[model samples]
Target: MKFAHDVIRKPVITERSMEGIADNKYVFEVAPNAGKIEIKKAVEEIFGVKVAKVNTIKLPGKWKRMGVYRGKRPDIKKAVVTLTADSKKIEIFENMM
Candidate 1:
């Protein structure tokens, strides 16, 4: 079993993600192999909040090239977690807004 920290890599702090806070939705970068259930559990365990829904998006890696060499960025998996109506807001994001 993966630890909550392992399942949830980090919070996504872009402008688009920040806008979700007002709707009780938060974005996170999750392990590529993690599923919706795992993400939901991880967020609930780490934040102590009830999760209403979970949506995931997988972005393919992009290829890049240097003068002589070529490489690709690692693929990313993101999860959008929506909290239950009565759940308290996540404090980490509260300070940012």
Candidate 2:
């Protein structure tokens, strides 16, 4: 198993993610190759919460062209972690204003 630090890169601090905080759901940006199981383990290990469910999405890379040059952005993997009702809350989101 990969280390928690390696599996979960960081919390995704977006307006949409913040809205989920009210529902015991947290968003995180994970490694491109990571799966839902890995993300669940990482979130559990790092946040000490029981993950009730994990939903993952792979954002397709976007293509951009500039001055006859074209490049594609790297794909991103995101995980939405839903904690069990009995689980403890992650404190980091509490202080977010």
Candidate 3:
């Protein structure tokens, strides 16, 4: 059983993510080991919002070469959490506009 805090690493703030806020959806950088259900529960508990849906994206690591050296970027996982229609807006982005 992972703690709610551990399930969600941090909020993902980007142009696309910011746009989602207007639709009662928020983006988060969740733990790679977390699943959709865990993400939904964690977000609901931490933010006090009713999560209606949870969409996840898994970004694979990319390979890079520099001066005959090869390196890989770290893989990342993100979750797009959509809140229920009647839920209150998250206060964190209340004044972002």
Candidate 4:
């Protein structure tokens, strides 16, 4: 079994993700192999909040070129975690807002 920290790689702090905080939703960059069930448990364990829903998006790597070379950005998996209505806000994001 993966540890909570291993499942949740990092919080995504983009403008869109930050906007979600107001609605009790937060975005995270998670392990590529992680599923919704693992994500739900990780969030709950890390933040001590009840998760109401978890939505994931798999982003394919993009191709890029430099003068004479080409490379692809690494693929990524994102998770949008929604907390229960009665749950408290995640403290980490609170200071960011």
Using Cα atoms with residue i matched to residue i, what is each candidate's TM-score against the true structure? 0.97, 0.91, 0.90, 0.95
Q: Tens digit of lDDT per residue, candidate 4, span 1-86? A: 89999999999998899999989999999999999999999999999999999999999999999989999999999999999999
Cα shift from native, residue 4, model 1 (Å): 0.8
lDDT by residue (tens digit), candidate 3, 1-97: 7999999998887788889888998988889989999999998898888999999999998999999999999999999999999998988777775
Candidate 2 vs candidate 4: the lDDT winner is 4
RMSD of 2: 1.2
Give the count of colliding residue pairs in each prediction: 0, 0, 0, 0
TM-score rank order? 1, 4, 2, 3
Local distance difference test scores for all models: 0.96, 0.90, 0.90, 0.95
Instruction: For candidate 1, give the lDDT.
Output: 0.96
User: What 10-residue stretch in candidate 2 is worst by lDDT?
Assistant: 88-97
Candidate 3: residue 24 lDDT (0-100): 91
Predicted model with the maximum TM-score? 1
Better of 1 and 4 by TM-score: 1
lDDT at residue 68 of model 2 (Cα atoms):
97
Clashing pairs in 3: none
What is the Å distance of residue 24 in model 1 from its true position?
Answer: 0.4
- Report how far off residue 64 is in candidate 2 (Å): 1.5
lDDT of 2 by residue, 1-97 (tens): 6898999998899899999988899999899988888889889888888999999989999999998999999999999999999998898888884
How high is the lDDT of residue 11 in model 1?
93
Q: How far off is residue 40 in model 1, in Å?
A: 0.6
